[model samples]
Target: RMELLEAFKTYFQQGVANPPGNYTSYIIKAENISRLQKLAELLTKNHIKFAFGGNQNARGFNYDRQKEESFSVGRNDLIVNLHQPAAVLADVLLEPKTLVSDTNTYDITAWALPYVYGLNAYASKENLKGLYPSLDLSMDQDAKTNATQLPLAWAFSWGSTENAKLLIALQQANIKVRQANAPFTIDKNDYPAGTLLVMRAENERLDKELAKTISKIATSQDGIFKTISTGFVDKGKDFGSDGYPLLTSAKVAIVFGDEVSSLGFGEVRFYLEHDLNLHPTIISVQNINSIDNAQVNTLILPSGDYKDDIKEGLAAWVKRGGRLVLIEEAINGVIGKKGFDIKKRDTTTKKDDQKENFGSFANKSKSNFDDAIPGAIYKINLDATHPISYGIGNTYYGLKTDDLIYKPFVQGWNIGEINNKSLMAGVVGKAVRKSLDAGLLIGSQDLGRGQVVYLATDPLFRNFWEIGKTLFNNVIFCDY
Candidate 1:
């Protein structure tokens, strides 16, 4: 599915993929604003109630240009909408009338251009004369990096999931890598804490043509390789300092259970293999006892159930320097257990349980189930100094489906927190609004030599959230 998606995204401009059904989706390859208006007028004349949306973010369904943030260049995605019959298209929207409301149907059906046709398009309320350029998809990927003189090491800004791919690709090619734990200025460019560094001293006997080998690997992964001259930096921590740590090849195993979220599991697998180019060992809950901490360093448990023995084994593994990553509701497995136990926010109160309903029984029952969060986006406040937040900014946007709130861990670092649990997008119930007023989104609890990493929300929601993907990569690569 990801291969097809990537192919569609890569070749959609060349008219390679077939348009699903008969929906008027287009790419404005011409640098003409009037072309966009002409198409909009045609739809308007047809009396089709349409909306303009950015090509990137899945928000802006029934999009109002005035209400949403301006979809400017170099900022938000400027993609066209997938126009179909109201009856067919509205079935996937996140409204009450949306047909795919079974919760088990899909992760997020919010309209996204990349998931749909993978092109740059836009519609406007007014004839705003925006400087639009035709996207040149035929550019050479090999030209991404120049053949610079081989210095002491190589480095690149680790701000995107693409950077993670480069790091993984280098490691797979048997190239040793190191990550800077502090900021540094090389030449004139200032890199943040999570900047990936490939030192020559580490990979001396690995390859004969080392510089070209790394450049080629980086180009294949669509990463810009910046050559480092000397370890001595103009400012910030130097390489000899405790700022640079050798990155280890990820020895990971994802625990898949019978009742575990297939969506979450699939997302983890897809992001790890398809996106990041790392193949993780697949472990079933029945085989949880088979997990040898000596063989695997990181154990990822998606949202699902776990037996007492499995949980107990996980606690011991974590104490023995094994990384345990818990996603969404999976944290419930070890919440009350020892070694990995952490405090959860108390949301239950007498006000809701008491007889305070003034509506019909049918409506009351509907409201009870309606409290289940479908999906929503929220602002995250992160400790920028922390390694987990190296590439991402202080404010990270995450898409959350469940109310898996946790209290701050006194012993561990709350790398990122949602100070205000207000909805940036998507619908939410009043009860959920009050319950998730504020909570931790990303944290780590130190058990012994190992740690239990917590992700309160599904970062790779439906395998879309680009920013969230970076955060997820941090959980795997940077949070050592």
Candidate 2:
């Protein structure tokens, strides 16, 4: 058990360790913003060394827009978000390659660290069920066999083309291989449908050496193969087809300006460039007039302050049949300024002018752009039939950190909606106001021959919320 636990720990550490990068960022979401702030404080008090937004007085450093801090716990370069729920980016030492493989490393690490550290804090505070670290070791169960009489043949599923290369590499290394007559299943995972199994006859010395080599390759950073002791057999269940549909590349341009905040821009860029494998050109908002619409299919504007001219130019581009994707604060910039006018829902507390309490209530009616929801999970009703909702289900969960209270759209379709039950955190009691009433979460407006896609809250927020990735992808790939 100790050995297994230690291996698991090493596995997780390697999974999070930076991969040839200056800094490694981890996104963490808690039930509420307070819990996340507390975790940041705890890390600071413990001399863990971190940086965050909002609380500059904390033990760790505060995020400075100018400085380039390398990911180092010692240097106190970790980035945390306290004003809104965001993913935390910290420096992680790159573990030696021999220690652990990098297969699905970032995805696994993102999920694991939050569960280990962030969720633990929430679990302790709210008395919620804490997540326990686990590894699926069912493969070990199939390996129990007589040591000398171990099966010589190995089977691999046709899940990936890389497995074929593995077979060739083994043969070139002098491991004898022949095709087996039958297909087999191990641990309920069916092998290739073509009865394609590679066999190496059990020669005492050769088989033992081959086993060691196979084990080393399986656990190596480059290998994706998993081995079982079972020999090849005939007439086993097929593991399904290993094919993917070819997708056309869309030219995506993201608007970046000197005045724009890097928080949302950075996260959106990271997802598009790294996760989605889409190379989007970073178009300056100042250079909006210089863009050639023919070269760009989709233009994304991250939540940030924009000049009226930039908005006017983008609005013109949308009218020329270009697809514009607006996120968070960007929604306000385009609305009313351009042909799109989405009025803010009246969330003001009613004030009786004749009453003595009017003075206090009048002060609260002022429009506050800083209004936010903060660390809440809201269910988004997706119109799957819409081009933007392609490949997505009927409903999806959106992390609503910002409250975009817009009046009913005068034109276009509401692709996504947030219902009353969608509220999960941040707002409570009377503070919830009329904003919680069924409101538009996502909508598209037709502008001449083009379209404007508006998302109320960030879907690829911090790149931690994996549920909304498809929705974001659809936005990138959808034909306007």
Candidate 3:
């Protein structure tokens, strides 16, 4: 799919190391759709050198045919198959060993396979080691020997799909991992069913190394991994003190369509299914009228140009006790609609009779607002007492990739707001002041028996901003 390819390009550009003269080849095997067209366009826009070939079946192209078809193809360089049944291309493609294989090369393989599969399959460390000898996959021998002793363990909630990926990645790196047989509690926080327990012997040196590997993969800018050290315990009296409620029954629906303007749809979908472990149903705008509302409790609208009919259906659903989460451009779609708006006050007129209320205002008038700061990081002050802010501290970091800013809604309860001096770049001399209506990063409003949540910028943008993940999880689990 084009969405998958776009996400791959973003990951390659931002996270992976790009060496000189190194090229990547992706083997896509599926029915050609509009997504494939988009993928071709994205590859061209990025100037990524690539070749495309496919047929009605797997036997259409043989080894000689593939080579003859593309004379530019080389055998010595690395090659990656995006999806399986790799047997379709295996005859023509070079093996990993035949193409300059090493630990670094294997490392890329480990990351790339996971990216392609997303949340579809799970690969254990032993399986990975058996497959790739170049991977220096080895678990601490003492750790396995002293497994029952008072060893240090890292506990990750099973609800997070990102955690699952991390668990797999760690395993691929030859680290020892296990799921808690029972519910466990660390400090005051409760971990639910299927919580991953990353354990190692209490060797300070090895522990630090393990931490580094996780940090490299997780990449939470605010240092989420560092904060877990204080709560480490093997068999404390407080173990399993409290149980976290499972959100398995809660169903979340994400809107997707043929809208050409849609952005962040793949990121949102990936984060929900892969990071949050919430398998969300993809609802197309064309079929919105046919779907049953009772099956879905929460609906997510990603940044896109939505049809008016789709917007009306969502609005009507929210009024009937269905929760709505609007991100970026979708925020504008629900403008002047029920339970989501800025509630702008007239600043020009003093007379009560001439007063008027508006939903949105221009951001250029504000001295603190910067127009579209790409990759800018900002601090978000969270209301810890609120359900959506549960388990999150007073403040966490959020990423902004757009220019949109709103005059904060005074009447609505402030669930999360941008902190003073929150600007990370652009116009460095200008001071970011706290205003009654300045940077309202996130807010909630009661609509009938349900709730409407609005986010000015995407918290799960590219699934890179790790600190905002808990807040997004809260949105999924919180009862509105």
Candidate 4:
């Protein structure tokens, strides 16, 4: 019940657009000791009508059905059942067909209420698939699946994306917005035969006339008004092979460090495999270490302890103009250290450090990590408005406890201080980096000819896990 109430608060008060009319809905579902009870109490305090029916029956109302319209319900007769079946709830809320009237509004004649609306532990597999079609374990489904995801709705949100659009509009209202590349691969020849290209007239006057002309030009175009093309190239095969000016070449250099095979190498490879035209050369520095022959623009030093000479060589590489990205602790401990202090002691027992402990990498699924990291933390300042963050939303990175940077039981990660004094922000929760402290805790530093971006936590790599791909993508693909 509290979760439902929180959902209501999230929808109504958390900056989401509201419907025209003030509609009050009484939700019924299985009640456990969740966030629902608190919500019910809050609603009661607000004088909102709420009735709870234990199990299935109460006051002559069937838990599964909406009372007939002919039967009158008093203002105080709100009934909510916690144990009704989802099918019954759906039968009460969603009408089979929508009857549209002259006003373009719907008159739902056979509506049914849905008890459960999203995927959860209590949800059946079929229902979860139905609710999240895009997440359907099949690629056969079409755009219908994509349209249902909450992310799409957020794209046109009131703030982030919308604000960017408004800024663009203000700068040059008649200017055409174009995509550097199509979201999906599409050839110019594949356009429909009847397709037409329409351009808005370049006008100095920023008025409704210009807006109307743009609309008219758009309406006169081909089958439909798809996204505009900026003529910029993307990290696609054709873009890479042709070698456009907007594109550049980069090679990833993997330096041997802790969790080398398990963490560092895999991440570097993941980028190369997914991104077209990007090449990488792996250089293991376990023995004789020198970066002189490492002809690479970007170097990734995975988390681990290394010899002092290796650290010196890396510093030299940076001084000569190479981008260095480091994770966890490496030689010399450039970041995240109380101070430069090192000590060693013999193990009390000769049992090799008490037989070591092991667990899942970051204790998260790949997909959850993918989405949660970017959306979780807050106040991620860019490196002086660089191309990586151009037209990109400021994102938060997620750090799990197992990663070397994780601090156990610390409410949030500490992004370095502003001016070396104020508190740093970070993500506060387990999945999403939702706090200012977390962002500050995982910060970036620029030095010499090289740029060092510190990802405080290891970003999980599975398709469903790496929520912060865009953040990483920007860093990797930007024109730095």
User: Which candidate gets the maximum TM-score versus the true structure?
Assistant: 1
Write the residue-wise lDDT of candidate 1 on 332-418 in tens digits. Answer: 777777676567988775675656568887675456744666666666778888877866657665667777788888878988787
- lDDT by residue (117-166, candidate 2, tens digit) is 22211111111111222222244334422222345444432211123334
Every candidate's CA RMSD: 9.2, 17.3, 18.7, 20.2
Model 3: per-residue Cα lDDT over 1-480, one tens digit each: 999999767655542233211122333321212222333344346443334332211111112112212222222111233222232222122221123232122111111221111111111111010112121212222223332333355555433334434544555555655444344456556554345555444323555566556555444311122123344444333323332222223467888886513557888888877654557898886755445668987888787766373546565677777787878777766676554655432223236534344535663334223221334445567776565654444555455555455556666667777645554222221222222224677888777667788887676756644445556766765443
Residue 24 CA displacement from its true place in model 4, Å: 17
Clash counts per candidate, in order, are: 3, 4, 4, 47
Which sequence of candidate numbers ranks them by lDDT, best first? 1, 2, 3, 4
What would the TM-scores of all predictions be? Answer: 0.74, 0.48, 0.45, 0.37
| Top of the candidates by lDDT | 1
Backbone clashes (count) for model 3: 4
Model 1 / residue 29 / CA error / Å: 20
Considering lDDT, which of the candidate structures 1 and 2 is the better prediction for this target? 1
Model 1 residue 210 CA deviation (Å) reads 1.2
Over the stretch 1-480, how does candidate 4's per-residue lDDT look in tens digits? Answer: 999988766654432232211122233332211123333443455443335332222122222232222122222222332222222222233221222232212221211222111000111111111111011213212322332222201011011212222323322434432222222233342221111122232232344354344443323321112322332223232322222223223456766545354555666566555432245676766532356534677777666655443545666666666666656454224533322122211113346524553646665444344223221212233333333433322333233332122221133212321211111122222322222222233444445666666554444333222223434544444444
**How far is 176's C-alpha from truth in model 3 (Å)?**
28
Question: Candidate 4, residue 326: CA error in Å?
Answer: 0.5
Residue 33 C-alpha lDDT in model 3? 21
